[model samples]
Target: MSPYKGNRKINIPISIFVVVFAFILLVIPTSGNTEQLITLDKQKLPHKFSIAAPEIRPLVYIDKQGNIAGQFITMFEHFSEQTGIKVDIKVMPWGRAVQQAKSGNSDAIMPALYTNERAAFFAYPSEPLVIFSGSVVLQHRQDTRKIDSWHDIHDSQIVKVRSMNLGENVGRLFVNNRNELVEVVRIVDGLQMLQHKRVDYVVMDALIASSLIEELKLQDEIKVIVHPEESRLSNSYLAFSTSFAAQFDVEKIMALINQYNDPDKYIKQLEIYSH
Candidate 1:
């Protein structure tokens, strides 16, 4: 009787072990098959994509010291490091660049302002790494008074570069009277226009305007007006191709941007490249 009881106990444990082992074996193969499907999906993405940047001053495409001047290089380098993707930077005219990105000739744009219309053309990461502030600057005219708000700009004839979008958020506020906004091709021309009293104001990015003013020695003529800050017209970002959403990883791109935003690290990194 004791021998029989011991045999029964051993058989029960052996049966449980066999059942558990079989279940694990079944699960392992199923898990591996699911993983393979995921791998296959990743492999189906397009191998390469292109990107473009609007000809924004000091930010996207700028020619400084006979060199392509802008933060676009820095932003692209960061993107490449994180995604291991190659991007062809085509420094075309602003209008052409937008057309290229819109038509899917390129995979993305380096830095772009947000707009409802633009949103339809490209994909954007939920977060923006770079923040931009713009202002209307011009030659310090003799009859200047306290310029305060967008309402103040209504009557003024402003000069902005052709094919440039201020952004949907601020566009409505600044673009009430299209006649007042003169479109110029070159910043030099715009500055010259301002100096010549051809335009009452030039809506320009603060940094680009400052850099150009210093580079061109236009401080004597142009001055930054201290009006009520157009806080609404603030911030733009790096945009990606919506079509390549599967091919590119958004998290990695965001991580790269976060690294750029780190003052302690990115500044040093920029200096290394700058020098």
Candidate 2:
């Protein structure tokens, strides 16, 4: 049907072309352009930042040479190397760590448990360094106070790391008897208090409790109760301060962190970190 015979012209609506162009734009991304966009995002992230980390064994702690070295520390190192974002670990007391993070003095804090108070300033990631199970520690087998269950410690003098939120079950007792619970700057100090009869129980991470007791030569003195298999367990995460989150994309950084997270590889890097 020679419809376009001898120099004939056909007119088409411009709107159809516009609609087709938009559909292409919505469905497809040019390969090189997409790579450039990703590179731009990574480039925008801060080159370096200080992460306030409390000295907790098997996770983060000051080594003999006075450098923060542990599973979490190694994780930061790996992340920095892979993402080109340097994360400096600043070892400090738990109280001071959160304080620095809140004041915008530090960009983030690591291996922290969640608390309603902390949610105000910190944005937590899904990847965690450790899962801490609460253990009721009593000084010397003779001191005589039973912690068959959490309720048993309602009246006991309990001391845990200051501002460290173990879990709701452990927290309820503290809320009920604020005076009975003493806050300490370090796990070592709490264990020391427990030994000196200054505190009746030092409730903290099971593995950390045993590790410190052995390190402090208190194995003969400190008794750890790991009963009531359902001890309050909390996963510790790398919490980013609000100021840092506002400065850059928190979720993007977190995605980078999680991308490298292989739980087995995590503990393997620290060779000795387990449970």
Cα error, residue 19 of model 1, in Å, equals 58
lDDT of 2 by residue, 110-158 (tens): 7777777789889876666556655544545557665465566666688
Model 1 off-target regions past 4 Å?
Answer: 1-49, 62-66, 78-84, 141-156, 167-179, 261-275
Candidate achieving the largest lDDT: 2
Candidate 2: worst-modelled 10 consecutive residues by lDDT? 266-275
Candidate 1: lDDT over CA atoms?
0.59
The TM-score that candidate 2 achieves is 0.69
Best by TM-score: 2
Candidate 2: where is the Cα deviation over 4 Å? Answer: 1-44, 145-147, 172-179, 227-229, 259-275
